[model samples]
Target: MNADRAETVAILALGWLASNDELGPVFLGSTGASAEDMRRGATDPAFLASVLEFLTMDDAWVTAFCDATGVGYDEPLRARYTLPGAEQVHWT
Candidate 1:
């Protein structure tokens, strides 16, 4: 039961950043090695931990985003996007 509407988180994140016009180049990864680096970083909880270390979002924001789009924060950072209660069986 991978989230019915996956990719929603990333799209919203990017869209929100774009809307703010503050999407610094520093927050993004290029398509080749940078992309690879991001993916790699995602898997290293410590790395992802560092990447998200500064976020100051409220749970309300996450809830609102999910409510607004009917999705979960299941976007694949480095991990497979699994639905709220699923076993994450698809990507293996």
Candidate 2:
């Protein structure tokens, strides 16, 4: 992953962690279950695609959501949504 993608992934991981437990979103207004959703998303492309789709709409949460769901990364969990994409955010 490039710097931008890597950064995006880091923030997302934070957001994903925030989704867990009674904590306020990893970033804010976090929709609980990013972690669970990611877990389900993994080994389940359909679910992953759904999550990516869900994120595309939520500009504010994309970062935290990704942070909370750091499935394809190697970083310690810190409850805080981090992914915040620019206007050019998109999924494939």
Candidate 3:
């Protein structure tokens, strides 16, 4: 759950999706993210977390991304929570 490592994995996952012509367009369209946004997000932990969250939205996409990047499917779940400000708040 290291934030640095999570950000790296998130970037790699985004790159994996971007490499696909079909999925790339879909991802960009769905996120409304341009190339500039992706570049900026590469250095932003919060934005990277959002990327991981976006990827986790689809089971099929998650499987494909994991297979392509050799990252475990559960990695995204761990990553999103690891990002700064992502901690769960529990009030009892």
Candidate 4:
């Protein structure tokens, strides 16, 4: 996934999160992000990637996000690879 695509997915996921009565507050509290921050972050690729990364942390969240956004379950994996500093660390 390219940065643009990943950012789009993240934005969509953020919208879903924000609309959920339970998860909305949890997401904001966990990330310490205000509504203002989310508005600002929507335009920031790195911030968007972080939002996706946060959602990918849990399988239930990933499933719910995917179902809500009409994306495949594997999208989060692809999005993670597109983010900055996502290079594999080969320690052999």
- The 0-to-1 C-alpha lDDT of every candidate, in the order given, reads 0.38, 0.40, 0.82, 0.82
Tens-place lDDT digits, model 3, residues 9-78 = 8999778766778877877888898978877888888778878888888899888888888988788888
User: Per-residue lDDT of 1-92 in model 4, one digit per residue for the tens?
Assistant: 77778777878887888788988788799889998888888888777777887888899999988988798899886887787656789999
Residue ranges of candidate 1 with Cα displaced over 4 Å: 1-24, 28-33, 57-92
Task: Order candidates by TM-score, high to low.
Answer: 4, 3, 2, 1
Model 3, stretches more than 4 Å misplaced? 89-92
C-alpha lDDT of residue 58 in model 4: 94
**Residues forming the 10-long window of minimal summed lDDT in candidate 2:** 75-84
**1-92 in candidate 2: lDDT tens per residue?**
24344344444543454354543343234444545555554444333333444444454444445454644323212111222232255686
TM-score of each: 0.30, 0.33, 0.84, 0.87
Q: In the order shown, what is each candidate's alpha-carbon RMSD?
A: 9.3, 9.7, 1.9, 1.7
Error of 1 at 81 (Å): 22
Q: Residue 66's C-alpha lDDT in candidate 3?
A: 84
Q: After superposition, how far is residue 23 of candidate 2 from its true place, in Å?
A: 11
**Candidates 2 and 4 compared by lDDT, better number:** 4
